[model samples]
Structures are given as C-alpha cells and as structure tokens.
Target: MRIGFIGAGRMGAPMVRRLVGAGHEVRALGRSGDARRRVTELGADPVSFTAAVGTEAAAVVVCVFTDDQVRAVCLDTPLLASMPGGSVLIVHTTGSPRTAEDLATQAATRDIRVVDAPVSGGPPDIDAGTLTLFVGGTEDAVTRARPVLECYGGPVLPVGPVGSGQRVKLVNNALFAAQLGLITEAVRLATRLGIDEATLLSALQHASGASRAAATVAAKGSVTAFNASVGEFIRKDVAAVRALAAELGATMGTLDSAISAQFPDTERKS
Candidate 1:
C-alpha cells in the first residue's frame, strides 16, 4: 500500500515504522524540518503538507492528538480532495462519533471511504503489533483499510458503521476510568485495614480482582504513580465520554460516580 500519514508523533511514529517495515510505501506529513527528520528516521518519506499525503496514496491514516486536531487536519484541509477516489481515510484519534459521521459524509462526495478507528494501548503496544483498534466503517471500507491497520494492530474489532468505533472507545475508557476509581478505593481500604498497598495489589493480581489496570498499578507499585503517568490521557477520554453521553441524553450512572470520585477534577457539576 502507498500510505499517507499525519501526526507521526509519539504514538504515530511507531505506527509509521510498522507500516514501513510491512513493505508499505509511507509518506508522513511533517510540518517542520525537525518533524520531517523524525519521519525520515522512521523510514517513511516525509511530505510537507496534508494534501501531499493523500496524493497517490492508497490510504491516508490520521493519527493526530485530539478531535479538534483531527478536524483541523481532515475537514479543514484539502487532504480528502487530494486522495484518489477509492482510497481509504483511517482516523485513529479518539473523539466524538459525530466527527467520523461528518467526515464520512464529506468523503462520500469524493468517493473516499472513512473509518473511525480509535486505538487503545500505547507505543509499546503498537511496537508489538498488539494495539487494540475499535473500528467502525462500511465493510468495504474496513476491508480496504485492514491491511494497513494489521501492520500494527491486534484485536482490530469492527464495531459498527462510521461512528461506532468512537462510541465504543468512549465507553471503554469510561469503564477503565471507573475501574481506576475502584482501585483507588481498594487502596484506601487496605490502608485502613493495616495492609500495605503493595501487598494488597500483589494479592489482588492472583485473585478474581485481577485486571490489566491492577497489573499496571502493580508495576508502578502504587495507584498514585500509575495515575500520575496516565491521568491526563484518561482525563481527556473521560471528558469526551461525558460530552458524548450528554449529547445523546444518556448517563454513565455509577460509572460516572466512580470516575468522578477518582478524578474529582473531571466531575462536571450540574
């Protein structure tokens, strides 16, 4: 595949390497000299602008940081128009479902297909080709995009149409945040019961309470350290999920309570 890539940053950089290693010809968008150098180092040809990424590309992957950035890159640029009629546009940012829907509508006019594929896991996961992708798009669109995605994805689930990937990612993040909240409470309980945090976490890892979150906390050796490392990203996802739920007149119920309790700063008061 001839691929166009945007946002070849921390997470996106690893993906570019994987795609290039998979024998795909990748052109990554690099707005600055430093950025271009980084892309070149990743073994992907560096392009100067967004439209250049789409030119003659089989699929253009947008792995930018946020929803607004994704909008600025895809909707606010000529990238889609520059793409070949049958090329695929794969969005890897986690954001509003409506964003993907809007992109899909816009891309349809140009005969480009859009896939919302918000990812879970980090650079290490991408390096291992085990990153989880919650994908949403038409079957044909997904089929076209799969080879590109499989270069660095594991458990590449097809959730539903256009926006479903974002919907599923939001829910997944919310639940994960709530679990962190529960872990916080468990730590507090252990403190009161005279059990050390490390001991409790270690015991829980072998019990039914074990989870990826628990294992992560164990590795960090404390809830505070673990939260400190991932708090900002989780906070961003929690906010997105909250906004999405409000737009749909849905509620997180207990999940909301737990997340708020854990990350009090994220709680939006009525």
Candidate 2:
C-alpha cells in the first residue's frame, strides 16, 4: 500500500514509522524542517502536501491538531480533489463530527472514500502498535483502510457511518474531563484533611475511585502540576465536546459544571 501521511509530529512520527516498518510505501508531507527530518529518518519519503495528495495512494492519513487544521489541509487546500477515486482518506485528528460528515459529502463527488478514524493512546502506543481507533465510515471505506490502520492500531472499530467516530471520541473526552475534575477535587480535599497527597492517591489507586485521570494526577505529584502540564489540551477537547453537544441539542449537565469548576480558564476561553 502506498500511504501519504501528514503531520509527522510526536504522535504522527511514530505512526509513520510503523507503516514504513510494515513495508508500506510511505510518503509524508511536513511543513517544518524538523518534521521533515523526523519522517525522513523513519524511512518515509518527504514530499509537499500538494505532491503527496496528487500522488496515487491506497490511503492518505491525516494526524494534525484541531478542527481548523484538519479543514485547512483537507478542504481549504482541496486535497480531496487531488486524491484518486477509490482511495481512502483516514483522519486521525480528534475534531467535530460534522467535519467528517461534510468531508465525506465533498469526497463523494470525487469518488474518494472518507473515514473518520480518530485514535487514542500516544506515541508509545503507536510504536507498540496498540493504539485504539474509533472509526466511522461506509463499510467499504473502513474495509479499505483497515489494513493500513491495523499496522499501528489495536482494535479498529467501525462504530457507524461518517461522523460516528468523532461523536464517540467527543463523549470519551468529556467523560475524561469530568473524571479529571473529580480527581483534582479529591486531591484538594485530601490536602485540607491534612492527608499526604501521595498517600491519598496511592490509596485511591487500590480503591474503586481509581481511574486513568487519577493516576495521571498522581504521577504528576499534584493536581496543580497535572493541570499545568495538560490543562490546555484537555480544555480544547472539553470545548469541542461542549460545542458538539450544543449543536446536537444534547445536554452535558454535570459534566459541563465539573469542567467549569476544574478548568475555569477554559470556560473563560470558551
């Protein structure tokens, strides 16, 4: 399979390496010198975005950040026009569900298949070929993209058509944000109770209150430290989920309150 990839950053770099290691013919588009160097080192041929999309490939994998970036690269740049008919475009960016649906409609006229295949886990998981993929697309599109995805993915689930992957991912991130708020609040309570933060976190790890978010807070030594490190990214995800919920006429209820209480800065940004 000839795979054209974009956004060879921390997460994308490892995924490109996985595809190359799996013996795919990988060509990557990187706007930065460092990104180009990284993908080149991983055995991917460095090419411009225009060149990458223009070339015939079985799949084009996009792994950029934000809905705006995704739209800019795929729609604004009009990469879909250049992609060959019957080829698959796999978007790994966590973004609005509507983006995928809109792109699918646009791609259909060109006879290109669109797959919303947002991923979970990080660079290490990609390197280990154990990242989970929440996929949404036509059955044929998912089937066409599965082999390339399986090169770096664990369970590649086709949840529904078109935007379903983003819908599920938004819900997943919202729950995570809620859990982060709970974990931060728990840590604050432990502090006021005169209990050691570490001791409390360790106890929680062995108790029913444990969660990945709790462990992340524990590893960072405190809620403040954890928030300082990942608050912006988490906040971005929370905002996306909130916006999507509003668009769908769904209520976030306590999850919305929890996010506002825990990450007030994000609420202000919104």
lDDT of 2: 0.86
lDDT of 1 by residue, 63-159 (tens): 9878999999998899998999999999999999999999999999999999999999999999999999999999999999999999999989999
Local distance difference test values of all predictions, in order: 0.94, 0.86
Give the per-residue lDDT of model 2 (tens digit) for 15-96: 9999999999999997778767877899999886655654788889999888999998888885777788999999999999
* Structural similarity to truth (TM-score) of each candidate: 0.97, 0.95
Model 1: weakest 10-residue lDDT segment is: 261-270
Number of clashes recorded per candidate: 0, 0
Residue 10 of model 1: what lDDT?
83
What's model 1's lDDT at 262? Answer: 80
